[model samples]
Target: MIRGDLHELNRISWNAATVRHNSHKQDQAGFLRSGGSTLFPEEIELLGEIRGKEVLHLLCNSGQDTLSIAKLGAKVTGVDISDEAIDFARKLSSDSGIVGSFERSDVYPWLEAAIAAGRQFDVVFCSYGALCWLSDLAHWMRDVAAVLKPGGRFVCMEFHPVAMIFDEEGVPKYDYQMPEPLHWDTGISDYVGDSGGALAVSGAENVSEPFVNPNPCAEFPYSVSGIIGAVLDAGLELRIFREHLFSNGWKPYRRMAELPGRRWTMPEGMPKIPLMYGLVAVKS
Candidate 1:
């Protein structure tokens, strides 16, 4: 009951966050239409050869990255819990002329159904802020392995667990080994820093007022060891693991600076810490 309630609250919060995130986002269709991709280089490199592969994207918020994969000639399906995100993803896919599918379902049930249905994919990709929202990686990784074809690969690029220990001011906040859900009262809002409400691209009205969503959010934290153990326990062979100094894209801290290729990193004179981690594991 507690887990279900947590998912419900987060689904509602993300539904609210998606609207604001979309508004700050500029020319999603136009950007893709012009051969631009939202995927960072790390994902591209980790994905290896995705062309013509069947790919499943878990918790694909708004299908932005999933569509980017579709644009690369992969047959991609994105699954998310937020109906608003899936709705917008379909619209974006159509508007950008990219062929892909998006489904609105909780990832656990969707994965179970996919496994029971014998639906398997050549690749399972989840990236950036993906792992924190999950209450447990053990169940998640087990189902993920079940949904992958034999010899299929799982590519993950997520914000490093250590990054969660710090506040925006470079001060330590949360513990890195938290194994339970953390309830947050502050409403999820635009992380893109768009205070001036504006919609980029065609066919949307630009509003100048800032949007507000009072919905609280909940997230779970898994230690680095916990994440690695789950994947290994799923019987997948861990092939590669890397930690990066720069973020995949989002600037979570005010003290950080953006570098080329849209990545962000801590400023000089600060200790260089791992902001993100990536891994590639293959079902054996």
Candidate 2:
């Protein structure tokens, strides 16, 4: 499929997921409503102080993290391709009395526009399951750099590519080095609450039912070098690259052991694996 077609399919699938995520009792919206941040401690430390700083969040689904950063006194703008997600994010921000701007646009195009408008930010932040959605990391990173001021920071925390190759049963299924986009025709499911179950997407609002998707969605996988190399190629200086043993959520594994700080890890005796990774780069 063409890039536009692929993006449309992904957008629809994400919109469906967003509807469920916005209402899920344990999703980011819920956590943020309870005065919790979806950001990890490592992220907070890496970002440092943001008081009066400008932050641009890419693929910011539902604005939970965007608003959380706004709480830190940052002037934040969130961009997402999913219109439903952006709408939900705006409503959540207003309801929570948090100041943030939400825009419905794909990341690359949005970054391009920001660059043309001479809009630059102190930080460009993206996290957890975000990079896999992009088809071209090198080009994406260039745009990321384009929207950042000189010496601006780019912080990315995402599921480890190594972890993504494994199936729910801890069995290796996919390639560790995937060079092409992977497509799935099965119905899309909410990654958070009620994991593994498909949700329907229709014209109705406030959908609380599950439905099967009739179209396929696509995702591109990149290795560690592919990720970090792109950042370097974009003229961003690598500052920190760290891997975590725990995941932000337990959606990856069929069974997991709960850990401190609401994190989850592979059950004991399972060889310790990198479940997530964080990268902090500075544009120079």
Candidate 3:
């Protein structure tokens, strides 16, 4: 992996270690709002059925999706760098009566260990908001490729880089097309919240440095071509890839009436670019 990528991985590790329990609890509400509704179920449905299939989830913050997949009869194991998130995920599994396993470790090392132990899965699943934290796509892809059994699938549904450019303000000034080189710095931003909105935390209420990480996680933007290339490099062949204007498992803000329940589309006459993309790739 590249030097910058290693730094980013370390940052994520640190963030996972330091993410405040209270803040994480608040964040879990957001995850349920977004993932529970659209991102999680959509990916699960797109994967068809995973009865008795072994699944691996990467960057599985808090493990809601992992547990959800487990509820569908997949023997699920989730790996995340954040200790607090993994703990909450374990609790969620227990509370929900979903049998699953979670591990706190960085992706590369975790996959290496899993491979060494002869671990393989029928599916490797990750989702939106997860990939942006990584610095190197190639290394990440290789790790996802390493622990998969032959014919196993790798599936991901992520917020398009295009969508990421628009912050809570909905400003379009940032470049949405060019994916940049990954870099890291020491800072924290609350991207999701109910009352205060993105990155706005009152001093009295907010935890000091609620999310801690050793590096700045770079948001690497990739075009459809870029995403396709990564999967191919990982010894996976594309089976299904779809870009959608709206996401059913998402709630961007309070005023987004166009996306109420299962609908994911921009208002009429508004620009119709896709907000997210889903991919289903099978091991070759």
Candidate 4:
């Protein structure tokens, strides 16, 4: 609600970022074609017994992880704001021979439509860097509650807000509570494929030295407890709130070391802090 032209500008920004980000993932289509999964270990463990469940993945950019969930035997539908992202998702689904349903819409209105249509899911899942785009966490949580059936669960794996408080030089300039929304004109980073060893795209390709955006985007950072409170106030019972030190795909700092499976963590002698988290809440 806070960002004016929320639908148009945000969609444009992500549509631009989606193409730029995926270009760095050399042969990503090849990876998926060989039955690759973009899921991290924490996600797999936390989402236990999802086979045959009706899973709704929100903010599911490009459907790499969405198709990964479908590979888990769940009937998964992915919802995203960017038309380019959803187009690539459907294309990837066909190219990779993975079946999934994709929708393009701003999450706020989409959730309302889902609720109005009486569409409810067994599990609502979203992950890393997903929540920051939303301006209203409380309303988002309320709508999340509306679209989940009784006994259904909401599962999220996200970059911890504690870790996000620090600036580029390790200064904690941001707030622990919800900070003022940040507007960025420079666009998103190629964070996913930046960790090195990205294979080359066989077809014609051009890499931008630094991908810039014509459209601006906004981000709203929330605290750990703020997220918990949002879920609780939405009438969902907090089942688990566990924090972790490693990050999936996106490295937070320069000094971080890479772990197995594309995960990154703080090197030895650095102060241990939660970089990411896994949360599960059930609709009671």
For 215-270, candidate 1 gives per-residue lDDT tens digits of 89898887888899999999999999999998755676768866766677889888
Off by over 4 Å in 1: 194-211
What are the per-residue Cα lDDT tens digits for candidate 2 across 1-284? 12666777899888776666655443444445567666668778878899999999998987877898998889999999998889988987877778899999888777788888999999999988898888778988998998888989999888899898888788889999976788988635655543322111111233345656554689988999899899999999999999998876545877777776557788887978999988899988
Extract clashing residue pairs from model 2. Answer: 199-211, 200-211
For residue 25, model 3's alpha carbon misses the true position, in angstroms, by: 6.3
Instruction: Give the Cα RMSD of candidate 2.
Output: 4.4
Measured with C-alpha atoms, the lDDT of residue 212 in candidate 4 is 56
Q: lDDT per prediction?
A: 0.83, 0.79, 0.65, 0.82
RMSD of each: 2.9, 4.4, 5.5, 2.7
TM-score of 2: 0.90
Q: What TM-score fits each model?
A: 0.93, 0.90, 0.76, 0.91
User: Comparing 1 and 3 by lDDT, which wins?
Assistant: 1
TM-score of decoy 4: 0.91
Q: How are the candidates ranked when ordered by lDDT, highest leading?
A: 1, 4, 2, 3
Candidate 1 has an lDDT of 0.83
